[model samples]
Target chain A: MRRIVVKVWEFPVRLVHWTNFLAILVLCATGAYIHWPFLSTPTTAFPYVMGWMRLAHFVAGWALLAGLLVRLYWGLVGNRYARIGTFFPYLTRQGRKSFLGVLRYYALLSPRLPPHLGHNALALTVYSGIFAVMAFQVVSGFALLGQADPSGTTYLLTGWIFSFVSNGWVRFAHYAATFVMGAFLIAHVYAMWVSDLAERDGTSGSLFSGYKYGELEEFEDFGPRPR
Target chain B: MAHDPHNPRETALEQYLESRGVDRRSFLKFCTAVTATLALPASFARKVAAAVAADDRPSVIWLHLQECTGDTESFLRASRPTAAEVILDYLSVDYHETIMAAAGHQVEEVRRHTMEQYKGKYIAVVEGGIPTKDGGVYGCIGGHSMVDVVTEVCGNAAATICVGTCSAYGGIQAAAPNPTGAVGVGELLPSIPLVNLPGCPLNAPNLTATIVHFLTFGTLPRTDSLKRPLFAYGKRIHDNCERRAHFDAGQFVERWGDPGHRQGWCLYKMGCKGPATSHNCPQVRWNDGLGWPVGQGHGCVGCSEPGFWDTMGPLYERLPNVPGFGVETTATKVGLGIMAATAAGVAVHGVAKSIQLRAVEKKEGN
Candidate 1:
């Protein structure tokens, strides 16, 4: 088997990935605390428990939004593997076949799998869904934030949401999306690990190093499958 | 009484006050209090007094639609109606269905005559919701549907002041499964300008202060998009809550009659809607400024907001349920349950995948 190493994930893409991961982690943790104050600090001694949690949640929310914006922009002008089309791989005939193949592989119905150096079709499509969910979280989070001060300029921008849904629902959706994102996180990690183990080619390490080792024959990508 | 055109009680407010033995100093003090309520500079007290004392006073017609008369009760039974209520006489209220002695056809004539005389220039204070279903047969006064009354009276008035949550956002009548198909005055008169002072029973001072601002400034005070006067509803109740220190301190009442409850800790955990509800209840308060809901150790029901019934409830719970679905299912419960299911599913998937991988490796070895 001839093995070759190729750079796949660009540095900006890697940065976005990690940034979103950290932001989501901080957001969920602090968001849960803000949603329900679990810790009871003494009033006089420690007056800013929820305050600090709120600040952290706000900061992480902004970070997530920033990372999402960067990723969205990069999708427009990045490498083939990093472009927006990669997120909707199912649009291509080969991508659809690979998607089914990936599903079959996960279902343990298939042994041999179509080789892709980057994300498999299923992973990419799910990532797109995760992105959409995160975008909704940001929008709903802003609407809730604006509820804090209804007369301010922030309210003026985001208050239009109240025209559609009330403050409680905005809050509920934002909170619920956390778990949806959490579910995605677990599934994503498991899928990546399975892919790395099957390929034995640093597929998981590629997240950090941006390089994947594969067979020269496997480099066919979605070109024509095997003749 | 009735509007006797031949023997008009056309006394100016200052003359009426003098006749009633109200001293100028106290009246000025009242004006200053009104100025403060309007959030205007104290120096504007004289300007406000002059505007209020003007010979040409605005005729105010208070309408009662599909409501509990709670707003009217609050307006009449204010804690200290002495100084504050002089402002009411200044408004020269032409017609109030509840308070006016004239009833039946005579009062109807009074309302019609007032609306016609002050065509395009009378303040219509609406106190309840208007029934829209079945041609507004749900609520009527003198054989006239509330829809027609509001459309006709408020249609030609200077502005309509929706005095309660019922008249502003349809109150309890507009809650889920709204049988009467009740709607607020603004919904019926969307073309006209409106001042919506929504509350289960709004603080009477806000109503009086809004009228004073209208009379003094020759235009309504600046209002939010909901048409609520910013002076009253510019800040959230939580922002000015006296127990805010407790909230920031992480001290909250875990349950009713607990140590935190006795200690007067924050009621946030008690489903207080102060964080989301915007009103000056914490500032103006109720019952003569003696105390408010939070002050009396009760959580705010968020009565002043647009749809407190549907949006701000279940009143005693911190967070609301799934909106529009009408269930007690909380977001946290549903969220945690899904996460746990995912975790379990992932665990099962992990074990199965690992076992399958071992089996595949054994097959390869064979």
Candidate 2:
């Protein structure tokens, strides 16, 4: 089978990913404070903590928006595999099968894994789901942030939602969603660690190196499919 | 007890008092107290005196149905004239089941006789809910359904005063499934002018006020659709709560018996339903104006409100959770980022694997 592989993501994309990861961790810790404020540290003692947390959240939000824009542009202008369609596998029947093929391979249900030169169908599906959730978080977070800034667009849209849902219920939903995200992060890390340990095919390193092994003959004989 | 021989029209009150043995000064004092309770000026006190001094003290039929006698307790402790004779002297309480010495047929006969003689002119003060379940079998007095008796008398009476939550809004007994199908007086007869005093054992002044308003104005005062006097049940307890300053400051009592609890902080976190419940109890108070629930280190459970038993209970708990935007929490956003990164990671790995396969394929081709 022929294999085709090419460089797609630039250094900016990788830097944004790692930076976002650290930002998320810091945000979660500070966010727990904002929600329950477990610290016996009086508001006077660390008056700046809540303020800093808010500042950090705003900065991170802007960074995330920037990252999303850059990623979208790259999807259009970058290599064949870097195209937006590659990240969305359920759009096509062949793409959907390849997505399932990746699941089967990971589950050890198949002896011969589907050879791919880009994101596997399962990975594509996950990316799509992530995109959807991030969009939702952005909307919800902005709405919350708007509470303090009545003049802000986020506040305007979300303020209406708050009134409709009531303030207490809105606050509770924000809390529950936070816990859900926390659980997802734990599971995600565990899965990554397991995959890296078992496969060891530069699973994590490929993020930095931005290139991977591909068969030239396979590229000629068979079209590129998700790994 | 002797009639003032000057006003010959005062003979009925005089004869009734002579038989019951209520003194004259105490009767005038009770009229003055009722006038004051009605929030009427001292000038109106003379009107009350004139009414009492007249021959006809309006006949009253006090009925108790499915209730805990809370209204009776409130009226007994009415704190105005400071003498039991005061209340007994003003009104010719012709029939009252709980306080009247007459038994079974005798009380029933008195009720019937009063209804027949005074009928459209008498005041019907109902102190409990009327259960209509299974043809009103849940409650009865003298083998007659209280519902039947209430309908018969209330339909013909000049005015009706529902004295407590049970009679006013069906109270605790009408909660949830409402097995007894209990209902208030206004619900049973839409045409009659019924004033509701909807406390768990309503404020005595409200009852007294309605009576005085009727006696003075010849009609009940304008009331809300719930039949509650707007003067008493208009504002929420939260608006007048003593710890309202703490609530405005966002200070809350996190749990029962906490330091904040001892300090008498806001009980919003402990499920004080005062913010949503309207009543004058916080201002008027209970036990002759000594204290109320909030004053006695307990949250206001909103007992005076409709469906309070279900809506405001597990009384010492926090309000239900509400969803808000995360200023601090962004697990969903972060998770999405992580998943995206992971996807990119998978893509990189796939490309690397492809490169390796390409090199192997070129060697085989060569």
lDDT of 2 by residue, A1-227 (tens): 44445453456656656776676676667666555434433323544444565577777766666667777787788667667778877788877788787777565454234555455577667766766665555656666666444445666575566435533345445555555556556545554554454333344666777655555653433354434
Clashing pairs in 1: B271-B317, B271-B318
Predicted structure 1, TM vs. truth? 0.93
What does the interface RMSD come to for each candidate?
1.8, 9.0
lDDT, model 2 = 0.66
What candidate 2 gets wrong by more than 4 Å, as runs, is: A1-227, B1-57, B78-85, B320-366
Q: In each prediction, how many residue pairs overlap at the backbone (N, C-alpha, C within less than 3 A)?
A: 2, 36
Error of 2 at B364 (Å): 27
C-alpha TM-score for every candidate: 0.93, 0.53
- Please report the TM-score between candidate 2 and the true structure: 0.53
lDDT of 1 by residue, B12-98 (tens): 666666655666677788788889988898899999888777777789888888889998887577654455665674464578877
Can you write out model 2's per-residue Cα lDDT over B1-366, one digit (the tens) per residue? 456657656656555554555566666666776665555687887787665456545788888989999878876764444323344435636888767777889878988998999879999989888898899999998898978989988887888988887887787888878999998887878788788888886776566667667766788877754677766775667777888766544456777888878878777767676754667777667766687888787887777766566555556543342225333434345545665675676556555545554565577683
